[model samples]
Target: MTNNMTLGQRFLANEWSALAVAILVGLVVLASMSPAFLTEFNLYVMLRSFCVVLIVAFAQMLTLAVGHMNLSVGALGGLVAIAVGGMMEKWGFPVPVAVLAGLAIGAAGGLINGLLTVRTGINGFIITLATASAFTGINLGITESIPFYNLPAGFVAFGTGRLYALPYLLLPPVLIALALAFFLARTVPGRQLLAVGGNPHAAELSGIPRDRVIVMAHTLSGLLAGAAAILAVAQLGSAQPSIGVDWLLMSFAAPIIGGAALTGGHISVAATALAVVLIVIIQNGMVLAKVDPYWVQFLLGALILAAVGLNRLRAVRAGGA
Candidate 1:
């Protein structure tokens, strides 16, 4: 395999490659460091742990694929969580109905973001960053600084219950990531998406709908975030104003480390899924290792920077260095 492949292209180009090895290595390290780490009970938690991150990772990957970044993903996710909780609790909506409302809020928010970015020509970073504050404030206001609690059983089952020993909600993110991978690599829209990302000028000249594409991207981002929020409520059995704060940071990091270009263009959804697993593994191992609590973010940041640098170096070489 080494003889047939360049270093940077190795993982992204092949499914059974370095990233697989990394996952295995991470598992081995975790198992060795903590005897309890590999049990079914803990594995369920690990899968659940990665679920939210995987959702946001896909959301960020989509935005970045279209040459943009959505800083509001975490905030928006929280907003949806609060919306679902408040709707069910205060507004007297049924659990399923409240969930639908949550999805509606997320989709509507994304539409506004997409329209604003497409129409106004503002930088996406600035737009989503502003939205983030707004979302956070709205979340705080909706909850009245108090957390929503004691979610119904139907909601909790999503995160806590299992089918044949697998967490129900956990399976969906994996399925989503796989479906996204197939879409991007094997579909017409997928290729068009890459063309739009790789060179918008050329894609526009070739008749691709640039504005529509971006809007769709943001819309999907919102959907994914909303779904994740619903799951968050399921897992926590409640909602909090700060529910999405930590995830906002980790979501962006996962895709970048998973082989997404920072400015958007090329990426692998399957790779992103693997990246989420790696992150979960790291976090789990950290807890088992009992290392300094503050070191986790530092470690993830450093890993992301390293991965991006490696990808860039490969791109440069492959482009004829």
Candidate 2:
């Protein structure tokens, strides 16, 4: 489609292109400033760290696509982490069984969120906020704020092992991103999801099940969140109550920066992937520059605002054109 366009036109038309350029620029700058930046060890570390964040972002992105928010993403993730951890460490469950149970729990949590929103006709923001508290309460009640150690050896190894600069952890997100892109662009249910988000009334008139799609989106969001939590457990070699404490911000940040509209019905898997890369680069650069870790929150907040403003401006210009 872009073959006939000029380079500038291509850049303007494809959101991911701009993100790719930004990532490239960030990589060059960081590599120059810190000799350690491009080393195999640092590269592996960055890749592994991004794996969980990318999945978490995708989880939130699904909810946003349905014109809703999932404030409970982090809380749900923390719950899943501990649940899976307890299953493995205390219940003598196998890894696969524990992982499946954790995902089921996440889906159930999401189901509650969906049913409440649909039944009560309350805004999703409110529904998710209330659920967030509920999820957190459950987590705290079960774990007592303690972490679960003694994860399986193979799982921990997969989280940390790498070939050259590529961590084994990188595989899941890559496959997931590709599958998501395909699903959104090509699948029937996927189209229905976006169609409902694009115009709920119109979709209903066209015989699409609006409530079902929203519920499905929420359920998928929870499943992905569960996957991310499990991965974090493997990476840390423990299931900490704090596993998802900081995910709320980054989960929203990457997808929004990737050009997902707050109003819904628009998202780009490729663009979101690039946005995650750019964010990871920025974080690594800060570490190399000896910046205070606390500043990351401020920076991410600022970046989100900037991205929203930029997107609004672009919309205005496009409308004008």
Candidate 3:
């Protein structure tokens, strides 16, 4: 009985519980209102949408876990998309090679962001904000706001391929979520990263090499952002300069709503995944309900504000307890 109560309490305390309930409610309401909502094609579209957003959410989640923010996530992703697209179209590089190169570029960009933040004593927000501008400028310069239209057939096929009702694109985020869960829960470096986020001074005193962990977090964030960019390219069958333009909000929204601490050292991969699902559902619901396109931005902002407020309340209650 004691164990059961403990488990129940833990579930209630988890941020994912609220999100899960919301998702269930959304699904029920949408399905009842729209006969097309649960159709195979609609379900596939929703799952496909989840692929890129989930990875982007994880990218921001990693930075948040280190008590930092990467305002450049969307910018970095856009730059990478353009780079890879150019490699395949202009330079005629094979898809695999271009992808590997893009990933490397992303890591390098992240490394620079981390080094600048640590060495200059600048807040990550400012550093990444500056870098975001640089990235956007480079992207615009290269493509002149035009997208790469010609991509490898195999690559484009992967983006559109579905196994029955399941999108092949769903595999990456699921694997990433599992890997992130294991890394955070079991690995020494992951623990160190979380430790630094939880309390940097204590972690430094404990010989955790705080700076290194921070850099690692940023680098991993970049890599994930790059991966998402690539997936976006595949999904769209074109490399648009605007691929990640909207990721900034969703990137922060999913993790924050999933219960990532702003101060860091606390995040739940499972919860984040559920949060993404909920967001996707909400977006889909709006489309099915024929909500005005202009209202989507307003709705997103309102949801984010609600999530932040709820988190603050939870923090206060925990403190009081």
Q: Give the backbone clash total of model 1.
A: 0
Where in model 1 is the C-alpha error above 4 Å?
A: 1-16, 163-165, 186-188
Candidate ordering by lDDT (highest first):
3, 2, 1
How does model 2 fare in lDDT?
0.88
As for model 2, its CA RMSD to the true structure in angstroms is 2.0
Model 2 spans > 4 angstroms off: 1-10
Q: What digit string (tens of lDDT, one per residue) describes model 2 on residues 1-321?
A: 446656675466667766777888998999898999999999998999899999999999998898888998999999999999999999989999999999999888888888888888999998988899888898999999999998888877888888999999899889988889898999988999899888888999999999999999899899889989998998898999888888999999999999999888888787788888888988988999999988887888988998788788767655554
For model 1 the TM-score comes to: 0.92
TM-score of 2: 0.96
Q: Ranking by TM-score, best first?
A: 2, 3, 1
CA displacement after TM-score superposition, residue 173 of candidate 2 (Å):
1.4
Q: Which ten residues in a row have the lowest lDDT in candidate 3?
A: 1-10
Q: Write the per-residue lDDT of candidate 3 for residues 74-192, one digit (tens) a residue.
A: 99999999999999999999999999999998888888888898888899999999999999999999899999999999989999999987998888878988999999999999899
Report RMSD for candidate 3: 2.1
